[model samples]
Target: MLIFTSVTWLDLCLASAAVYLVKQLSGKKNPAPYPPGPPGWPLVGNIADIPHNKAWLTLAKWGKKYGDILHVKVPGRHIIVLNSVKAAMELLDKKSSIYSDRPVFAMGGELVGWKDGLAFLSYGDRFRYYRKNIHRVIGSRTAVNVYEPSEEIEVRRFLKRVFAQPEQLDAHIRHTAGAIILRISYGYEVKDNNDPFVDLVGRAMHQFSQANDPSAFMVNIMPWLANVPEWFPGAGFKSLAREWRQTLKETVDAPYKFAKDQIGAGIAPMSYISNLLKGRTLSAEEDHMVKWSALSLYAGGADTTVSTIYSIFLAMTLYPDVQKKAQAEIDAVVGTDRLPSFADRDSLPYIEALVKESLRWNVVAPTGIVHCVSEDDIYDGYYIPKGSMIMPNIWSMLNDPQTYANPSQFNPERFLDNDGRGPEREPRTISFGFGRRICPGMSTHRSIHLADASIWISAVMSLAVFDISKIVENGVEQTPEVDFSSGLVRRTLSHPEPFKCSIKPRSAKAIELIQQDVNY
Candidate 1:
């Protein structure tokens, strides 16, 4: 179908201009070399070379041929792919002062108005303020520990949900994460089912992923396309962006109003926003900071944890031996009488390693949030121009054979120092991010680590009670494929596509434990 039949003329003109522009840029003289990458087209640069799915694989393949850092140009954009943790850390980390800024995303940031959120906020006063707000709440292990009770309570509820309907494992995880984040972020408790706020988050986040996908919308690569009026021929993306922008607005506004309203009634539970709002009068700017920062907590923790935790179940289903080993450790250390808790975290080394393995294995946010350089500098004899987009190829870093032996295998023991060989490098160091822009996100140090305790609690509690195995149809066991998909950031921790598994209580005792009262 020629969906853009009326706008083919417009697209052709844009392509011609793009071709001439790239030709001009490539014809320039450079003081030093750019990192080697696949040769792009004569006209459109590397636009055709970019894949719409599993992009990390293509980038990693380029690394094998072009070295760790590969530069590619597409239309008006210049991209540098860092396929090794060393290269990422050297540039994105050691050179943090000039590397922490975020790209101005055309579709998500400009069109849908998500740039105000911490994830896409530029490096400036508001970025620092947002980070300060986030860190004050969950900056440290001690601060995050404050939410342990809430996390354990939600994971227990998750166990009950999975027990009741294993087929809806995906929905159960999403609800549980939303419940935990909303409670902490707004002090608002979500209903057991069909919670409006959770539903809103689900819808809003889906739009978020679709909006940021460069390949999904032409406006992302060509920002001017966003200027096309809704009534213009083949302007469907513009229409979609408008609708998505409203959803993003509600995602930002609705929860914020709820938290403020609850505070007004003098019946607000303590939460991230309430902690900031309880007795303080704020300037409109401060209020904006608190509101969006609170949503940042919701946006970051809620979605990604779903992906990380879901992968744990998928890991258990496909690798029964690893699951049994970890479960045995749980039984040995925590016992069957009660589910595991944060207090037992240090005592269960295997479970801890299992959590680390899961983080590495799943590779959430595989290609991390793009980092925009603030100035130009030379590194390793390469001319890294200012405004060149840097993508930390996190998927390659975690799975690099040089970093981990048999990187493709799901073995928790790789994280355990055994037989005189030290354990492989911890995945968290690479997974969360690199340098000033690294996800310690709200503050300088935490990034995805905000959810570390949450992931552990969920994993420990679920493992303590559930036995996950391959589902059998017609008496034949079906193995769940280990597939993790990525879009832009919000889709960072999405569900495994076509996930299938059977989750059940290990025994009547396990059932009783999952059935415990889940009030904190």
Candidate 2:
């Protein structure tokens, strides 16, 4: 009986091999040929070369070495990086129907329940519905209306915070942006940066960022390991995934619950969650959907906005000439008597240029959410296979020497015409992403940045005055040029390790205006 059983097992294994071979032979050939990339090792592919931080920058360097489009193999995954605007437009825009899907990740999808998150959801009916709803709420027209009051209040608050404690400008800027989004989404104002909601959101973002780190899970490379039981001793990732899931659930559902309770008591303020909850019964699936949407707003809006503001500050500190030019424009247009507003945006051309340049200098969403091909497509004689992951390398495009001279320089003039008008309706960098996945918060983001930047430069006469250049260790100046954190969303540029700077009122008039506006 033992001999018979051994022979049967061997026969089954042989049959399975034969079936797999037959299936491979019967499968259709990849219609379009993939682009060339660095020679990858078997099984692991190029995974070894990819760093946890600044993966996009590394990929962009590889793109320059291997031409505009490069194909990379990461275990079971096939990734295509479109390093040029033309290729990105061809794949992610022109052929969006076959290229709008997102790649499936075991942890992000099944474990964390991100299958329904608009940023990660596949291209399907549900994704379409979510996108449509997001558009209706935060799209262009609505974004303008939604931004008006928030921008006014937050810019004033930010100025007051800076005037009070210039040293805490970084934290204050972060809080101001977070408060705006929190109020918009949940009708909950973050009165203090230490508010539980703020801490919870910050912790949740850190958890998500860590979880999404390339090396966070081996399952991203070999997904079969995801099925390992959490009770198993070696299942380290299983515990981490569970913790991440819990964090996400709390961060997402807490605000939702708060809104629901407020609505039940007929005391809910007009906010995104309140609007979503009105006249809608919460089915299990609907509840999950609503929570994900609200969480997206919170997470997406807060980090990116704060990062951009930091970048703006860094740019001003690094390029004093540019800062002077922008301040001159602000002084000429809005003057220092009062803070700048959205209505003054058109008049302050240089400030708009500064805003655009800051976004292009170091995009917050560098690689953006990965794009998956829904079907086989051909572009520029290269075959892009169905199910392949496509990345529009925004870093490469923003730094393309062909488009912008001295690409690394933080010069806002690149985005302005000789006459000081903004770049015409041509393509800018893909900071907001591409095609259907373009950020729904684009208008709101732009408006906020414009208004805030204008107010900042107009209110503060000299960023040089607060310059920490005098306080330095080892002969290094504390400047924005030296401070930058790595990763898709880098921190401030050229940030001095630790330095002190002073903030004094540019004028008594500016101070009085800020105080009155603080109460406004």
Candidate 3:
């Protein structure tokens, strides 16, 4: 009996040793190799160090410590942050073929129905189809021509609102920009802030931002947890996921139904939905495509553009000299006798500089959308494994001390030439994004920004006089220090943050031109 027991024990020991050998061999076969970063704890990884508010600011500091290509591990995931323009361009742009795919999130894609959205769609035929359709409506010269009338009307309306109630400048910026995109994309107008369509889109966008957050759901990191039945009372995340999915579906479908109703009644205007629906039948895939595309436009066009305009206002108030220079250029070129038009953009160099500077100073999407690697690749002799998530750290790139002297200072002169000509400034760092994932809205955004900035500078001479120094805290007045918060997008950190300034017409001619020329 003792001999038999010894033989059985030996067999068990041999089985355990073989298992260990296999695991070691497998690990060696698929070794994870990327740049160096602080070691992460088991399970949670480096999630605790990721700042919820100012993530980019923290990321920039980390970049300073660990070179440009830093590896970050998040339980079962690998994130590579490209901190410089050179690295971003090399990996994201030059090797875009394998870098265009976005990381898959079960909640955002499967539950929230983002699989069809152009921004989140995987690189494939469906994505190609969506891009082709988008380009047809908003990409090329023909689309720009088609959008001209609406753009003009909206800008005029924006100026009129600014002239009538300067206090509501923020709301005006939101409305004018939102309305034009709405009109052009869906043949709808934002009649008021309370508009259901506008409110629904806003709510949906907020939810999307939250859902996209890595920490928003544990199931995102450990998706197997989702398999637990929703009826189980203790399934905390399951319940929340259900609610988010429901809200997303409603938000996405509401505008879609409106578009469909309009199409069915033959009242369909020459908008994106109408154009696409003209010759196409709604297949299941196409339905997904349409809904997601609509959601993308509503969310992407509204939030980021509005945030940029807000930053512009904040910058103008904080940096009076920058505002003064922009106004001076507008006055000299277009004069106070006429409203600035797209054609005058070439001549108004200073206004152009101010726009570029505003974008740089307080970047809208600071960390930028994440990109995923499709295959294993090498960069500078470092192994970038397949399926590593890429973060183009825009904050680091934009604030590179070597590229922009006094990087923290809000100076438009950095982008301008000595002759006062706004030279085409190449990004010493990547801000928008890299490669094929570069913002398709670049041209559209440039035109809108230039037109809006020029008008604001010309009409509101007091923009230069606005003082952001006064802060009211606990019913007491004091001067507030300039501070900003970081996130996927950066926002002004300090509050009671109202700028105090008197806005007056730059000239009598300016008032007359604004009052007469503005069609709204």
lDDT of every predicted structure (CA atoms): 0.82, 0.66, 0.65
- Residues 1-520 of candidate 2: C-alpha lDDT, one tens digit per residue: 1112122434433554565567578978776677888887644568777665567778888987999999997655678988888888777878888888987677666666556667778888767666665656666644446646665676677767887788786788678877778877787767655788888888877766555544455555446657878775445667778887888778887877888888899988777788778888878877777777877767767766666666666666567688677767767777777666656767877776776777777566667778999877777777777788898888778778877778788887776676765453222436667777777654533343222332334323333123322235476766433334553223111112323443466567767766774432
Query: lDDT: which candidate is best?
Result: 1
Q: Write down the TM-score of every candidate.
A: 0.94, 0.85, 0.83
Off by over 4 Å in 2: 1-29, 279-284, 419-429, 443-478, 487-503, 517-520
The TM-score leader among the candidates is: 1
Candidate 1 structure lDDT:
0.82
lDDT of 3 by residue, 1-520 (tens): 1112122434433554565567567855534456877777544457667766767777788888988888887655788988888898889878989999988766666666555567788988877677666656666555656666666667666666677787676677667767777776787766755778776666666666665566566556555545767665434655666787787788778877888889989887777788888767889988787667766666656655565566666666566677777777766776665666655757766666776776677666677788999998888867888788899888778888887778888787888786875443444235556677665543433343222332334323323223232335677754333455532222212111334333355556656655665332
Worst 10 residues of 2 by lDDT: 488-497
Residue-level lDDT of model 1, residues 1-520, one tens digit each, is 1234366636745786876877678866777988888988665678778776678888989989999999998766779999998899899889989999888768888988888888889899999888877777788776777777887888888888888898998888888889989999998889998999999988887788777766566667667777878888767877777898888888889988998999999988768888889889999999888888888788887778888888888889989999899889999998899888889988999988998998899888888888989998788999988899999889999999988999878999998989999999988888888877666433353333558777888888888888899989999989877777763243334346757888888999998998888685
Candidate 2, residue 315: how far the Cα is off, in Å? 1.0
Q: How many clashes (backbone atoms < 3 Å, residues ≥3 apart in a chain or on different chains) does model 1 have?
A: 6
Candidate 3, residue 135: the lDDT equals: 58
**Which pairs of residues collide in model 1?**
131-442, 439-447, 440-445, 440-446, 440-447, 441-447
